[model samples]
Target chain A: MQQSNVYIVTFSVILTVVLGLLLSGTSQVLGPIQKKAVELDTKKQILGAVLEASELSKMSGEEVFAYYDKRISSKVVNIKGEEVEKDEDGIAIIPENVDIGRNYKRKPEDRLYPVFMFLAENGEDVESFIIPVYGAGLWDAIWGYVALETDLTTIKGVTFAHASETPGLGARITDASVQARFQGKRIFDESGELQSVNMQKGEGRDYSDDAHKVDGLSGATITAVGVNNMLKAYMSHYSAYIQKRRSGESGGMAVLN
Target chain B: MSTETAQVTEVKKPAEALLSKRRKKLLSDPLVDDNPITIQVLGICSALAVTTQLQPTFVMALSVIFVMVFANLTISLLRNTIPSRVRIIVQLAVIASLVTLVNEVLKAFAYDMYKELSVFVGLIITNCIVMGRLEAYALGNKPYDSVLDGFGSALGYAWIILAVAFFRELWGSGSVFGVPVFDQISGLFGDDFSLATNGLMVSPVGAFIILGLIIWVQRTKTGYVEH
Candidate 1:
């Protein structure tokens, strides 16, 4: 069937309008639910760093959100270990709103780091501090939360997620069992210099005695190096806060049990 | 494939039965004889990417099937009005919209699957099976027949990826859909017995090897040879 130029132009216009309207309508309808799901997932990841994966898995979406609300308090800080109450746009900075990927692109000194404090049952003392770290993986961006014990040197736990890392290899970073290996590992050496836990190349070797090294995925050398550099860079970026807290310079230490 | 397209175009009966012999063939042909992956070899990109795990591959298959059926129907309905000069863009628009719908629904309902599949979901827009169906089968056929053809092609794509995922997961991770099948079998023996999974099966190269073997076996059985 041959069509006139007028008919073709009219058909294209109508088709474009219909498709545009259809897509926008679908997005509008599903926007809230998608946003809620994403918010819950982010909370789950942060909680996964501090709590058990099995425990987090057992809770529903509302329960997770409620648990996060009840137990977690957050504050944003700059590279100087000073609190950043607002962003450059004068919007109040919250842990939920701080984009680690965007912050990672900026200069280290200019970045705002969000610290999520996992509160104890009494809700008075902090149990572990969860910090977000972001970097490149083998194929794409990788990021995760690293939870540090009250001493601010030992790791309590960690939870990793990647955009497009190789599954069963570089993507093993997201595995809870793999993340469990970081438990009890120390980030600072005996000399008080921040070493930041390293993911050494190769897997299934004993790093139990090592203070700053963990066994890496076998076939994912680049992703392991990515994690290593990410940890080193982010830890040193937050070292000011770690050092200040370790030295009891922060007033929060006065309330420590 | 050209013969199949020619057969579709030759049928002009306005009141043909919904499940006529021709339509049924359209539905069944892609399962093995004219498969999108093994036979036609259209959508090998996602077949490799999502087949590492059974769970994500299953979800990916369903997403593609949904996108294919609807995109085919929509394009077939509009096939006459679509300007031939800009038909590719129109087909792309329809497929992209359907893919976005799938992506949104998955994000809203199955967030875990959504995260697991990630970029592969968006890549469905570029999957040649969907576009090939739109241009070849849908543009020339009735809406209902086009839907059946799309479903058949998607099913063929699905089964191949699911099969790839099955072996990949079983060997690569010693599990099936996250269940430890190999580990349990190993446990039946003494503690000395343990299955060490082959890491090669977990990578894209694994998908390549599995797909290659699948194509070889399929072609040998069907007596299909490229001249």
Candidate 2:
């Protein structure tokens, strides 16, 4: 059957209105739940850097949130290592709310760095500081969290995630075994210069004795290089904060220790 | 005589029961005889892309099935009113909306699965099987028959991709659904024997090779010859 121009126009308009309403309705209804899921995932990644993945996997979302509240406290810091209570917009900066991906596009100095501190059992003393890092991978964006011991040089643990990478190749960055390679690796060399941990080319090499080198994925040199660059860039970005903490520890606590 | 029989059947088709033999054929024929992937070769891109792992492929299949069935039904219901000039656009709008719904639902309820299948779920809007079925069957068929046809085509697409994933994940990662099967097999024997994983199977090339073999086997069994 032939449809006249007026009828066609009317049909198209009605279809657009109906579909627009339906889509907007669905989005509005699901928006909060989706936001919560994303928040939980981010928290999981942050905690994954400090806690065991197996343990985290077993916890429900509510349990993970409770555990995060118990063991973690956070603060935003500037490039100069000073605490940032409020952002340029005058809004109070919450470390958990900081978006690393959005900040990644801004100038290094302009970015707000959120530091999540893992508190010791006494709950007051800081155990390890987990810093989030972001960069590009071969296929898409790559990001991770790195936890540093109180001394602020040794990597306590790490967890990596990627948006799109070759499943068994570049994507192996998320593997626990791979992240475990970063444990105990120091960011600062003996000379006290910040030298970020390197993911060297090729796998199966024993980097156990090396302070700054971890084995790379065999077939994923580009992704390995991406990780190497990401670690170096983010570590250097946090260097000022690290130096400040280091000096503060030695300066204030000299008699107690 | 054949023309007279065809006319008689055509006259009787509308009054037939919901699950009549003709409708059953509409539901079952696509499994092998007119498969969206193997025989019709309609949605080969996703079949190759998501087949690298069983878990994501399974989710992809489910999403496609959901999208296809609903898209077909919606289009069939609106078949009479849809202007031929704007029918493609209408079909696309319906399909895209349904896919967005699936995506939003996944994000809210199964976030991990949503993350794993994010881009692929959006890509379902472009999968030709949905469009092809909407145009070929839904535009002229009744709603129930269109739905059955859509389900059949989606199932046909699903089984092929799932089979490809089975081989790919089993060989590529030496696992099934993330379980390290090869590790267990080696552990069963000891250090004396171990099967090296085929890394090629983890790549898109592996999907192509596996899909090609599947199409070849399926076509050979069905005796389908392309002119």
Candidate 3:
């Protein structure tokens, strides 16, 4: 009911200046700590998916780096079976801030060295190059790394994670139990055609079906279909690389593990 | 002008007599007695939406407390000059600006948690808990008392939310902070892992059930009059 011009002007200026100071000050102080946290967390996720949490936890981050270093080799191979980046480092760099509109789109330029984690007995190493697959899930996008033997046929290991999904239903993709089913499964049929893992339905999946089929998710069928679709989409895009690896080409899809 | 003159004179009485003892009422009142969400039934949407989990609920409560305390203090400081015709707008501008600061800090530092919260944090600008403090208590008090009033209102909102998140995470997934509270048989779930959900902890609707159950418990513990 009351009014004063002096108070109005002073309040606006005071609030604006105080807020400006607070916003800038807090970010300047907290920005780097947040960035480092994110970087470390990503390392944890990559390690967790490739190695058992119990095993990975036993090793320090440097040891994990050393494991990936000794076993994982980064390659920037093009679709034409040519090495894109080859030097002493053996690390292929993927550009950041990729804009694919939706996380499900194919922005082919975003391809680079896919990180591969190999697990075989000592000295034998792994004989496959693994690649990361990004696809749509039930409530959000899902991503996983799929490793292949040097032949690009048999699967080595698969790790998956989701951004947003129903915890009990669609979120099953992140469940280690669900993802573990993907391990040791063959990704190709006897004829050498791509037969990526399947999410089985009601009852149980007969992994020994006449056809090469992994069990599909039953309760969350749509999310299962999403994983199937994304798996196909990723395989198709890199068909050339897959074909090259299958044909025993040496330049692309070299064994890291 | 006459009304202004009369009100000014009225305000000059012993500080105790000029303002009603709204302090003792608001301070101790909301914390337990006349709690907003649990007791009075206000601002339950955010209490449910953000409290489906723990970490975000904690952050949301702190943000509301900060916003409320400052908004209340500022609004009270300018109580004498706020134009009657545009009072709500004035209160809103103060709240909105503070909320923006909160948003930026969350984005720059807690970006991941901020993404998890998504639009809910921005929606804080509309929270009745903050607005109610500004309009009801801050509009007529000294700055310090108004700040205290805001803090009390926020404390009321926080406890209810924490309780909601605790139960939701505990029963829905049978876990706390992502650690499994329930065990699974080996090789039953996937990759030789079997974890159970207890099946009830997955949706926002589930949050409502848990919240209602909590409200029932609180009501039985503390009887109140219909005001």
Candidate 4:
């Protein structure tokens, strides 16, 4: 090969080989950090479901951890309203990043855990907690953690999130303002049958403000309607557990209605 | 005996060698004339997917540029030694390594964007830009020319895709990077003015329309007809 050819060819071979190794090796080094980022984001989402983002934002990370530690206590409960072994039973294991279908298959009798958060709202000393709910959305499953007020109906606040939905449309299921509307909304009628809140289109009409309505995504009727339907599904399934807690049968920790 | 014959053959240019002018055409013409994918109808899948957002388009452009430049240079360097029987296998080996590196880097520093990019980031392995550069130019040219050729075609492809994404994000959501712009127009028109754009803008259908408009503009500007 000529002088110019040898210089460029040898340089090209060495450059490609060395650079490719470096790029691949560097990514492998960064994998753990990236994975940790994903885990932290997931933890934040779970925490947000129970606490208001505005309130959570007010506290530093350490303060938030301390607050959650003191305010929230978790216990495993049986189908018969009795406390199960702390180490055993179904455990309501929400797989950190897995889908609802897999998470749902862990039977209630296997052991479902309930967590209570003690706080005060509207001049009333209150105990609030979150219950996990799952249902279908427009293109996939819709799931959320709903934080309930002492009455176990009015939403204190909510944080909803989803996967693979249209960006500005179905994705609004996770938006802040939409979640705020669920606040002060009742989940059941006086008779104790599940009457979940409605998400209505156009200028929202608050049914009674306390047991009322939320404004639906204007152009995303299907996704809006999915959320409303799923709310009913969550409310009805969890009503039995809520009923026992309401009767003060699970101690005075939670008052349903 | 074999060594003497090899030494005798080393001094002469092969009769079958592609001339300099033709090699220049192979490198330069993809940007305008005889484009491998766009004009010649090759790798349209990526053209539709990543063009919905500018950031992804930028990443895709970077990936394509790296792959094209390196794939061409590597192929050109190995052109003399590679056996005719195994040349395609060798080409794939080089392309695959470049793509894996692209995936790994994106996965490392830009994890969120990498997740959003998903399979498309990995799909650069199959993107014909790498293959076309290898076969049409790299297999015969010197390494320097191959590198420039790779850069030229990748840029040619990127310019069109980024321009398409620019309009898609701007008109689709009336926002850039999720910040609501076009707020003035929306406010003036009231409810009649919709800044909350059609989700279709991010969808594949939007990409098709934008690409067509681009090709139409490019054609009109160049007065070229595709048969």
Candidate 5:
């Protein structure tokens, strides 16, 4: 059958309009659910950095959210460690809303850093602080949460996730064994300088004994370096806060909430 | 008249006409002889990527099946009206719409699987099998036959992926559908059955090897040779 130019044009236009409407409608209906999924996923990852993987995996969605709501408090702070106040409308500026992905584009001094405080059993004692870090891996983006101990110097735990890192190699950062190495490693040296944790190449050296070094993935040197750089860059953003906490100037972990 | 006689024959045996020998072939041929994945080697990317684990592989297969059948039926129904000059775009529009709907539904209902599959679910738009069947069978066939062909080819693609996933997940993670089978074996054998998983099985290389072997075995058994 011969199709005239007019017929083709009309048909194409109608088809495009119908398809566009269908897709947009689907997106509109599912957008909220997808947003909730994303929020839950972020909360779960934040919890994963502090809690055991097995423990985190066992919790239901409601349980994860409830735990997050009850125990974790977030605050947005400037580069100088001062809290960023709410806008003129009095709506509190939530730290969770401060996306680090976008912060990468802004100047260091202008960036608003978020700090997630994990409260202990007493609800007053700050157990650990979790910071989100992300950087480019060998292939794509690699991101993670690093939880600092109450002292604000030692690493409590960490959870690494990646976009498209090489599976069985760089992707092993997501493995529990690799992340476990960061536990108890000091982010600050003996001289009270922020060193961050380095993902060193090779094995046999005791990662636990080194205050500022963790075992890197065997075949993923570029990714390991990427992780090292990400940690250094992100952790430095909280240097003022960490220093203030270390000085005991706020009378031993003041409750921010 | 000939038209009156044709109407009488068509109405006389509707059931027989529905399940004719040719119709059966349309549904069955793609399962073996004209398999889209095994024989034609279409859509190898997702097959290799998602087969690293069974759960994601299963979800991916189902998504492909859904897209294929719906896209085929839509195209077939509009075959005559669709301008030949812009038929490919029309097919693409139908397929993309179905895929986006599937993706949204998955995000709402199966969020975990959606996250695991991630971009792969989006990549279904680019899957050759869906487009190939649309062009080769749907454009020229009736709606019912196009649906059958789409279903058959999807099955052909699915089984290969599922088989690859079975081996990969079993040996790679010592699990099936996330259940640790080897751990159970170890429990039964009282620690003597400790099995170290093959890391290669979790990588793309394992999928390549498994698919290659499957094609080889299938060809040998079917006695089909590429000339």
Candidate 6:
């Protein structure tokens, strides 16, 4: 049978319209579930950075959500460490909704940074603060959260995830052993200057005595440097808030705790 | 008279029509002798990439089977209407839409596996076997036959991948389906009975070597020789 130009055009248009409708309808129905999945995943990652390993492993999804609700408080702040109460239009801002990736494209002063405060079991005192940090790895984006002790200078824990780093080398950043090395590292010097954390190169180099350095991944120098830069860039943004807290001028701390 | 004859033909035994000898061949051949991955060497990229673990590999196989059957049936039904000049585009539209649906469903129900599989789920649109079968068989066959062919090819691809994953996970991690088999054995045989995992088996290179051996053994058993 002959297929004329008009026949081809009509067939193509109909096929395209039907497919577009089917795809859009599926997305519409599943959109909310996908959003929930993303939100839950973010909460899990945040908890992974601060919670005890034994406790985290035993908790289910509902328990994690309940824990998050009962113990975690978040607030949005700008680069100057001032809490942001509202946007330009006077609408209250939710810090958990602030996407770091999108905010990364904006100027540092204009970016909304989210800080998660982990409360003690009694919910009166702050236990730790988790700050999300992300930057480019060897191949693609690498991201993680760093949890700091109440002093806001000593590292309590850290967790890392990557998009497409080398499977055995750079991707090992997500390994528990690699992340455990960050424990006990201090981000501030004795004089109270922000030093962040350095990922030092060379194998078998003891960083036990160095409060500001951790051993780098064995075969991933570039990714290690990326992690170092990410930590410095993000930690510096929180320096003002940390300094204020250290000086006993905790007026701007979120009252929710 | 013509209406009465059509009715008689429709009333014939439905079982024979569903599982005729020719249809049985369509559903069974690809499991071994006419395997898509081993015999035709189609869709080897996913075969090598996702076979490092049994769980992900199993989910991937199910996803492929779903996409293949649906894509084949849809394409076969529209074969007559599709213009030769734009058939490839039409086929791609159908396959991509199905892959997207599968991805969304996976994200909703099995979020962790979905994350682990990641881009590979989206990569189904380019798996070659799905497109090849649609082009070669579905375009010229009835919808029922095309569906059978889809199932056969998917089974062929699934079994090979599952076999590869079994060996990879066992030798590489000393486990099966995430259970520490070797750890259990060592516990039973005292502390000295240790089995060091082969790191190479956990890598993509291991998948290649395992798949290559599978293809060789399968071909020899089936007495199939390449020209």
- Which has the greatest TM-score? 2
lDDT of 2 at B193: 87
| Candidate 2 per-residue lDDT over residues A1-257, each given as its tens digit | 46689989999999999999999999999999999999999999999999999999999999999989999999989899888999777988879889999999999999999999998887788899999999999999999999999889999999999999888899999999999999999999998898899998888999889999998899999999999999999999999999988887888865312
Q: What are the TM-scores, per candidate, against the unseen true structure? A: 0.93, 0.95, 0.76, 0.71, 0.90, 0.88
DockQ of 1: 0.52
Better of 2 and 4 by DockQ: 2
Chain A TM-score compared with the true chain A, each model in order: 0.93, 0.95, 0.75, 0.67, 0.91, 0.92
Higher-lDDT candidate of 2 and 6: 2
Which of the predicted structures, 3 or 5, would earn the higher TM-score when compared with the native? 5
Tell me the spans in candidate 3 whose CA falls farther than 4 Å from its real position.
A1-14, A54-93, A96-103, A106-128, A149-151, A203-212, A245-257, B1-25, B73-112, B177-179, B184-200, B220-227
> In candidate 5, what are the lDDT values of residues A1-257, reduced to their tens digit?
46679978988888889888988988998899888887888899889889999999899988999999989988878888888877447878877666777787788888888889999876776889998887888998888899998778889999999888876778889999899999999988888887999999975467666788888788899999999999998888879877766665456444343
Please state the Cα-based DockQ of model 6 relative to the true two-chain complex. 0.38
Per-residue C-alpha lDDT of model 3 across residues B1-227, encoded as one tens digit per residue: 12122223235445663235766666677888778887877888887787656777888888888888888988888777665545687778788878877877776667667767868888889888888777776776678678778888888888888888877877777666656665533344567565555456557787788878877877788865466
Name the better of 4 and 5 by DockQ: 5
Best-to-worst ranking by lDDT: 2, 1, 6, 5, 4, 3
Over 4 Å off in model 5, which ranges? A86-92, A248-257, B1-13, B17-21, B182-196
Per-prediction DockQ: 0.52, 0.56, 0.32, 0.16, 0.48, 0.38
Predicted structure with the largest DockQ when compared to the true one: 2
- lDDT of all predictions, in order shown? 0.89, 0.90, 0.68, 0.69, 0.85, 0.86
Per-residue lDDT of model 1, residues B1-227, tens digit only: 12223334564457878688988889899999999999888899999888988999999999999999999999888766677777898899999999989998999999989888879999999999999999887887768888999999999999999999999999999999999999899999979999999989998899999999999998989999977
Question: Considering summed lDDT, which 10 consecutive residues are worst modelled in model 6 chain A?
Answer: A248-257
Candidate 6 has an lDDT of 0.86
* Candidate 4 to truth, TM: 0.71
lDDT of 6 at B69: 98
Docking level of model 4:
incorrect
- What local lDDT does model 6 show for residue B210? 96
Whole-model lDDT, candidate 1? 0.89
lDDT of 1 at B172: 96
Task: Provide the TM-score, chain A, model 4.
Answer: 0.67
Candidate 4: tens digits of C-alpha lDDT, residues B126-198: 8887787787767876687788788878877777778778888877767665566777668888877656666
Worst 10 residues of 4 chain A by lDDT: A91-100
Among all windows of 10 consecutive residues in model 5 chain A, the one with the lowest summed lDDT is A248-257
A best-first ranking of the candidates according to their DockQ comes to 2, 1, 5, 6, 3, 4
For residues A1-257, write the lDDT of model 4, one tens digit per residue: 23356654665566568667876676678778667656545445556876767776677646665555555554544456565544435444333444444545666454354444554443235467666566677887777777888678878777776656676677877878778878888888888778888788754555454575777786678877878887786676567677877777457554432
